[model samples]
Target: MVFIRWFLGKCILLINALTLPKPMLRIKADQDKVDKKTQFFTLYQFEACPFCVKVRRFIRKNSLKIDLKDAKNNMANKSELVNNGGKHKVPCLKIEKLNEKTMWLYESDAIIAFLAKETELS
Candidate 1:
């Protein structure tokens, strides 16, 4: 059963790699705006997680420059997720505003939606 699960996981990863999406076109001015807006955002994720993959693909496709934190292997990142985000969940976005306000956003779909909205304004 373990072997079967591992094999299926590998297959899923293979498919995800083979069908990777293309990044969106980045205009210099728009990219600059995106950079300023997302400078305080960081993403916490596990490499092999499907939801993390989805968020990563969205980030790549939109050319967002958000930093990625690996919670699977990094003990500090794991603790940060638990302590700051209030949960140890992949695909959680840490957004810090200019006023020092912070937000912990979870769920892949919502993260993608938030990025889309922010980028559209850029």
Candidate 2:
């Protein structure tokens, strides 16, 4: 059962890699805006997670530059997710606002929507 699950996960990852969407063209003004918005955002994810793949695809398709933190093998990142976010959830996004306030966002759909809305202004 473990082997089957691992194999299926690998297959899903392979499919995702093979069908990556082309990134959107970023205009100078839009890029600048996006850069600012993404500068403080970090995405915590595991490489093989389907939800993470969805969020990653959205980031790539929209040409967003948010930093990705791999929590699978990285102890520090994993701990950060648990300690700060209150749980070690894949596809969690850490958003830091200009006011020095931090927001830990979970769930892939909500993260994608928030990112899309933020970038739409650019």
The prediction achieving the highest lDDT against the true structure is: 2
Give one digit per residue, the lDDT tens place, for model 1 in 1-122.
Answer: 98886787687678889998888787788789888999999999988788998899899888889999999799999999999899998899999998777999999999999988877861
Clashing pairs in 2: none
TM-score list, all predictions = 0.90, 0.94
- C-alpha positional error of residue 89 in candidate 1 after TM-score superposition, expressed in Å: 1.1
Poorly placed runs, candidate 2 (over 4 Å) = none
Best candidate (score: TM-score): 2
- 35-98: candidate 2 lDDT, tens digit per residue: 8879989999999889999999999998999999999899999999999999988899999998
Off by over 4 Å in 1: 1-5
